[model samples]
Structures are given as structure tokens and as C-alpha cells.
Target: MKNIRNFSIIAHIDHGKSTLADRIIQECGAVSERELTKQMMDTMDIEKERGITIKAQSVRLDYVKDGEHYILNLIDTPGHVDFSYEVSKSLASSDGALLIVDAAQGVEAQTIANVYLAMDNNLELIPVINKIDLPAADPIKVAEEIETSIGIDATDAVLVSAKTGVGIRELIDAIVERIPAPSGDPKATTKAIIYDSWFDPYLGALALVRVFDGEIKKNQLVKLMSNNEEHQVLDLMYPHPLKRQKTNAIKSGEIGIVVLGLKDVSIVNVGDTITDAKNPTAEPALKYEPAKPFVFAGLYPIDTDKFEELRDALNKLKLNDSSLSYEPETSIALGFGFRVGFLGMLHMEVIKERLEREFDLDLIATAPSVVYHVYLTNGDMVEVQNPSELPSVSQIEKIEEPYVKATVITPSEYLGNVITLLISKRGMQDKMTYLNEDRVMLEYSLPMNEIVVDFYDKLKSISKGYASFDYEPIDFKEGNLVKLDVKVAGEVVDALSIIVPITSAESRGRALVKNMKEIIPRQLFEVAVQASIGSRVIARETVKSMGKNVTAKCYGGDITRKRKLLEKQKEGKKRMKSIGKVNLPQEAFMSVLKMD
Candidate 1:
């Protein structure tokens, strides 16, 4: 039998996990030069455009070394905190993980968080300190830190560079030896987990799965446990880095593709386990939960007319990302905007960037929100998705909000500043230790809702984007912050803003109106923008039109140019907001840029 191995690469955000993934697939002899592109696992346009692995991807490579064929099942996982649930699911299909760390940055908080997940999954850990060829790399120090922090001996940590292909061979050799071989009963029952999948405009739904046990064959009947959907597997194939080729079926230890699943990509659960219905196995499915959506906001288009178009784009995106949830929501104050939930603030930005960059859409978003539990006097339990629904203390029995255990790793010089900033964000330090002479690591217990909103971005800004932080859900605690009312045009707009400390009511109101002013268009007629805290105006601004200042003006032989300009402006006015008879372009809504 050919030697079979299953593994995955886990690391912090931007630590070259996807890049290392490409190198491993190539070394497996699955893909070739002409057939390969950068970060092949990140096959989606949004994934490539954003430089983040949004989904977990599995690829099969056939390696021939010393005249022996080695079947390698490689699962590429998302490194960002946003996709923790998906990463945990990817671990379910793997027997070991290559903990790729940036040698220069040493061990980061995300690295530690992922390590804990791997340990929880009972997956073997192989520390592979990547980017060793970088100028700032201190392999020895990183090895020592890994030993001290992860409790994994540093002696076996391999120094490798996913960029230059350095130490790749040794890394592969270690995989062939250290990682355990597949031993599950191939004939017991069919079970596999869909690590990641995509919808082909041509091929339908293509799913990449790692067979945990039994076997899956082309044209065989299969069932998706999450939704209980059954389908006939139309085809099966393995990764041909150079060219795709059809495979008959894959055994328990193999990883490959399945198609004609019929169900939409969203129905295919990433962390969900699959098994044969007739001979179902009792093995508990891999223990992993979906990444919690922390950040909340509204998404709207510059041309409210194209609101449907933007919704379609998001629907297409959500087909692949089941974790992203929303419903048709209208804001009496801000007009119609969907209340979006995200894993974190970066997750929110990534969504915005994709909407703008990939689909070529313009969008405006409100401040993010954290989920809150509201308990009523009648014993009714409600999970408040929007901050505006928070019941007053007098009306509620109690409230609970999500909490997290967080860790921050940064240079020693910024230790004091980091702590001050974290404390300001309602983070309480539990432990602080020096990693070496130049670095210090701090562990804290914080509200998950905080970090998922703007805590990550704020921390990076305060630390010059040098500090790395990672967190896992700890528990829930009652919060003291109250929801700030954002009213426009003298009406309460619940979706216009969020929950904030009493002291920040003014600043939050100011920021919201500022963003609206910047994004709201300049109408022909003047429009007043007032950001108030419960009828108290914190800031006010007015958008005044140009008032046909350049209308019908022509001198010399410039008539043709002016006519073209007027025609273009007319089309633009059609796309902009209209107040009375005046046309307001989309850009007028955003007034903060002018202030900046």
C-alpha cells in the first residue's frame, strides 16, 4: 500500500500558512509549474484579492520519492482569528498540524491559540518555524520560546522558509516519518468532513473532503449530516497541480474532491462530520464550534437603487460563508441597511473590502455591535442581535455578554503602553511575562465582544501595528454599558448606532454623524445632519449644493466640452441622492473626509 499522510498548516494571520500550503502541495508532486498559481489553495477571487484564506481548503498530492508513491492529504486552514471555527474544523480531518511561525516574530498569541485548538483536537503538533531566511530571523530564540510557551520541545522544530522553499524537503521528510499513518477501517462506514468548497459557475458545487473512515466512490450515494441532504456523487478527482484528472474513488486515508452535491455551498458545513446512513458510526464528530460573529453593522450601497445588487453580492458570498448571518432589515433613520454579524472587526473590514474591490460596489457601514442576552420578568430568554434592543435594568432580571481570554505579544518597549491601551478597552491583565530581553507577553481576560468589534484595530494602531493578539471565548458576564440612541431628523434610528459606555455617548454620536456626512451625497437642496444623544445635539453639519455655479456657462469654442460635461453630470445626478430638484452624488454622504 502507498504511504498515506494527512496534515494541515496552522499559524497566526499573515504568517505564510497559505504560502507554505502551496509549497507542500508542490513537493507532493501534485501540481506543476505551468499549472500552478500563487497560493493555489486560495482559489477564490475574494480570497486572493484580500490576501486572507477565508475558507479551509483540502488538496491531494501524489509524491514520488525513492521510487515510492506517497499520498499526501493537505488541508490549508485560515490563520486569522475570524475563521477560528473553520480552522478547528480543518483540524478534524488531519492527524497532525505544521505549526508555521514567523521566525522573526517568534511565537505570537494567535500561534498559542491555535496550538491549544490542536491540542484539544488531539492532533499531533510539529512546530515548523517558517521564514527563517528573513534578515531578522532568530531561529534559536524562537525555538526556545516555543519550548517555553507551548511546552513542546524545541529540538525538533524545523527552520524553514515557505517563500524561498528553504528546508521544504526536510519538512516533507519529517511529515513522512513523524506524522502517523492512516489506520481507520476502510470498510466500516463512509465518513468525511467538507473542509472547504466552492460553487463553480460551470461545475456546480465542488467540495474538498478528507475521508475520516470508510470509502467514497464516484456515483455513490452520500449524505450531508448537517442538513440531512442526500446526493449521488457525480464525480471524484484528486489534485493534479498541473491538470485535473478523474479518480474512481478515495479510501479512508485519502483526500480528494466530490461534485454534484446539489446543495448550495452554504449547506456544506466546514466543521460538520459526514458518515454513511445505513452503517452510521458512533464516533463523536470532531469537537469544533463555528467562529462566533462578534462585530455587527449595516451594509448599504451609495446608489440606494442598486441595494438589490449589493444584496445579491452578499448572498453569493454567504453561500460560501455560512457563518455570516443577516436578515432583511430597514432602518427608519438610516434607510434600509442589513444588520451584519462578523467574527471580529477585521472580519467586518474584509467583508467591506470584498464588497468594494471584488464586486465593484460602494458601501457604508455603521459601528459594530456585540451580542447581548436579555432576560425578561416572564422568564422569556432573548438573544439581542442589535444593541438598540437592550432592556433597561428595571425591566430585566439580568443580562449576559460574551467574554474572552486574550493574550498579547509585543516588544518590551511597548509593554506599558500596551497594558494601558488594553485596560482602556476593558481588558484586565491576568499574567505578564518576558519572552526574552526585548519582548514581553501579557495574558488577559476580556470581553469577546470587545475584541471582535474594534479592539484589534485599535490595539494595532496604538502599537504601530506591531502588537499581535489572540483570544478564545472564556464565558459570559453581565455588562454595565448602555446603548446610545442615534436619532436623525428628530426620530430614533435604532440601527444607526450601538452600545457604548455612558462617557462615550458624545464621541460615538459625533463619529456616526461624521461618517454619514462623509458618505451622504451633496443634494441640490441643503440637508441638515444632526448627531444627537437622546435629542441633545453632539454635532451638526449642513450639506450645501454648488447651485449651478458652472451651469450653461460657455466661452470661446468650449461649447462642445461643456455640453459633454453637462451630459455626464446629468447621468451622475441620476445615480445620486435627490433632495427636492437638486441631485446629490454618492460621495456627499461622507463628510468626515473633508474634516480630515
Candidate 2:
């Protein structure tokens, strides 16, 4: 245990966390130089393409220091704010963290957030300034900023270039010397924390756990503390960047993977405690709160016949991602589908992409919305997850929308633009401080709905990609909110509904109809695309029918004959308008996502 070091790498997105992991793995001889891949810790293809870590991964490394062998368990974590819960879980399972900061970029919003999380977990911190190979590298200034903003001693911070493999050996040495070894009793009852899990077609659900007390061996009957369900450990294995190595048992202060051989993946939950079923411990390893989603969206298959396939895919995905939650729902425009909840917009995007790519199903996702609390005049409160389910304006007295406390770090040059953008989103300034002479940290409280849309993208655009943003749920606050419904040819399209503030309902409705007009194809008859708050339509656009000259067939006919033909054609159009159903393309539903 004294020679074992368990730690995680935490940083903002694109700060070389994954790259640093690759360098360390190479330096420790975990894998040969020829076998090493860029960002080895990021195993998912999507992660590599996006240059970000979406899932947490762990690896066991054997490092020889001064002729003494050491066991190093390094966990790689996602850097996006959407995956903060995953970061917390990784931190909980580690004894220390390597705080990676981009030397040129200095500290970011997510960096501060992750630092606080690591501090809360009581993990030893090793600050490492990465990207020193860049021409604009400023390690000295960055170290000073970290000390001033995070209040951590940066004099001992490790300076390294992850891309160039510089100072990697020094960083590894720091990990072995600074990070404390895991402390637990091998003789005590079994107690392990399941930080991550995944589904295997033949082996069933595999749980990635950190053993805190006692030892977990093959064929041991272990109970999940979350539900007190017992499952015999079919096998044990140590995680590797390239592959997993089989192990007979994993002792205290060690991290390993346990195979339960249970076909039902739902039974294996992350953040659950594992203990000996026969000799149960007095308490679980630790208390961990389940992840809560902040954004809600509907995922419907383009072909309704594939709904079941999508469900199965989601279930299989859920086995690995416990944060994903969904329920069956029916849409008038979209047909049968599931209303899925996600941690954030990026989370939603990742899930949608996975479902489409992994399951090979074409899916349409509705506009993301935040859960609203509706307090009706009847003294009853209801939670509205879907905008279409919102009560009528007459049925409700007050409506409350979830708000978030957002933290933004930006250069002083873009301070004006950042503030203006926040104010436009109905943000209330909470506090502001200067992190340095040119960098400012601004705090604001804004509606989650505003942030759920394209707020992050807008922030980056306004700041010219020089700013970083992070947010946390604050609380539900009363707002003059109303459900905005989009109607196609006098019928409401439930899938295109959204909740918006009354002040912007008219303008947003106008935009929705305008975008819909551009996307909805022309029918045989004129179609009225209307946006309504209730029975009253606030905005409308017309999709005119393709012109037809019925009178041309009777070029020289009498006036009475032409009039009769015209009346007949008019009557036919009226009937067609009544029965004509508009077949909107997938792009029409997506248009709502772009509504300002």
C-alpha cells in the first residue's frame, strides 16, 4: 500500500489532460513507445474526434523508481462542465489529482470548479503546467495566477509539455512522492466503491471499483449497498489503457474491475457500495448522491418502426451511463419516442450521437428544455419536463423555471461583450473579481433555459474563444413564463412546443414560424404556420400552394363555363386544405432549436 499511488487528472477542456495521460503512460513503460497512441486514455472514437473526454477511464501502471517497484492507478476524467458529476466520482475514488493547466491559457472556469471538487474530496494536489512547448507559453505567469486565484502554492508546480514529452518523468516522480498512498485495512470486511461500470455482451456488467477495505476475490458473494442485492464476483481484472488483465483478487488500497456475470445491467449501478454479503460492514464505503439531469429533450426515431431498437440501445447505454434517464412519450408530430433527460446540452448531443452511431438508428431530438415548476391556482404544484405537458395559462397561477449560478472567466478585453451577452440572457450579476491584471472572473445567476440553448456557443463567439464557462443549478425562481406552441395548418405540433418568457414569446414565436415556413414544404393548399401562447395566435406565416391554371384547359370556353370551373377548383382546394396533412421534414422540428 505504501508504494501504491491512486490519482486522477482534472482540467478544463483541451488543457492536455488526455495528452498528459499518454505521456505518463509512456514514461512509466505501461505500454511500449510503438504501442502508444495519442490520447490513449480516451478510448472512445467520439472522444478522439472531439478532442475531449466524455467518460472516465482508469488504468494500472507499474513504475520502477530507484529500483523499487510502485503501483500507480491513474484515472482520466472528462473536462467539460457537463461531465462534472463524472469528475466528482473519479475524484472520490482517488487519493490525489493532477491539476493540469494550459500555460498559455492560464486558469479557466472549469479548472477552478474541478479544483474545488478535488479539495472537497480531500485529495492531494499536484499542479502541472502543460503546453509549455507552445510559442506563447507563460508558465511563470500561469503558476502565479493559480496561486493567486486558487490560493495553492505553485512554487513546486511541475512544468511539462505533454505534446513534446518534456518533464513527464518529473511529473511521474511527483505523483509517486506527493500523492499519498491509499490507506485501508485488508483484514476488515469488504468495502468497495463502484465509480464506473459498463455492459459486456458475454461477460455481463463489469464494475470499475476502488477497494477501500478488505479484499475482493473471484467467486466472492458481494452485496451492493445501494439496494442490498447480492451477486457473486465472477472474476477480477486490472484495467489497462489497451486492454484488461485478469487477476485472482484485488486487495485493499487497490483499484480493479469486478465482473458480476449478472445479465441484467440495471442491477449494477455506479456510485454503489460493495461489501461482503456474508459478513456485511456496519456502514457503506461512502455516501454518494446520484447524478441529476438538468436538461430534458425528446428523442424520436425517424422511422417509428425502430422505436424498440432505440429503446434497447438506450437501455444498453444506460447500463454504462447511469446519469441517463428516459420515459416513453408520444408526440403528435414525432410519433412514439422517449423523453430523455441529460446533464447538459453536450451530454444530450453525446447521447444522441451514440444512439445514432452505435445503434445505427436515425433519430430526431427535440429542442432541449429545462424542467419547470408550475404552481396552479388550485394549490397544487407540478413538475413539467416537456413543454407540451405544461398546463394552460388559465390553469396556472405562477410558473417557476430553474436557474443556474454561472461562472465565467475571460480576458479584460472581452469583458464588455461578456457582460452584454449575459444581460441579454436575463442574467443577474452576482459578483465579479479580477483574477489578475487582464483576467476577470464574473459570476451571474441566469435561467437554466437560457443557458440550455446556445448560451455557451454565444459566449465563446463573443469572447473570440478566449473565455471559459461553468455553471451549477441554483434553484427554481418564479418567472412570467408561458408555453409557446407551434401549429401547422391549424393543428398544434406537440414536438415543436417550448416554454418561454412572456416578454419574448411574441418575438420567439415569430422566429419559430419564420424558420418553419422556410423548412415546411408546400402542400396542395395554403398552410398556416402559427405560433400561439393559448387560443390566441401571436405570430403566423403562410406556406402558399403551388400555382395551378385550371382555366388553361378551357382556353376559349364561355364565361359561365369558366366561372363554374373556377368555383369547382376553389371548392376542391377548400376540401384539400381540410384533409391535407403536412409532412414536415426532420429539419422542421430542428428549426425550433435555432429559435432565438
Instruction: Encode model 1's per-residue lDDT on 421-514: one tens digit a residue.
Output: 7887778889988878988889898876556555676678878878998877777787766566544334455555466556666676677666
* Cα lDDT over the full model 2: 0.93
What TM-score does each of the candidates earn? 0.84, 0.98
Per-residue lDDT for 296 in model 2?
Answer: 92
Report, for all candidates in order, the number of backbone clashes: 15, 0
Can you write out model 2's per-residue Cα lDDT over 1-596, one digit (the tens) per residue?
89999999999999999989988888888898788888898878899899889999999999999999999999999999999999999999999999999999999999999999999999999999999999999999999999988999999999999898899999999999999999999899999999999888899888999999999999999999888899898999999978789999999999999998988778888888999999998887888888889999999999999999999899889977878999999998889999999999999999999999988999999888889999999999999999999887789999999999999999999999999999999999999999999999999999999999899999999899999999999899999988899999989999889998889999999999999999988877999999998888999999999888888878785799889988998999999999989998988877987876
Model 2 residue 160 CA deviation (Å) reads 0.2
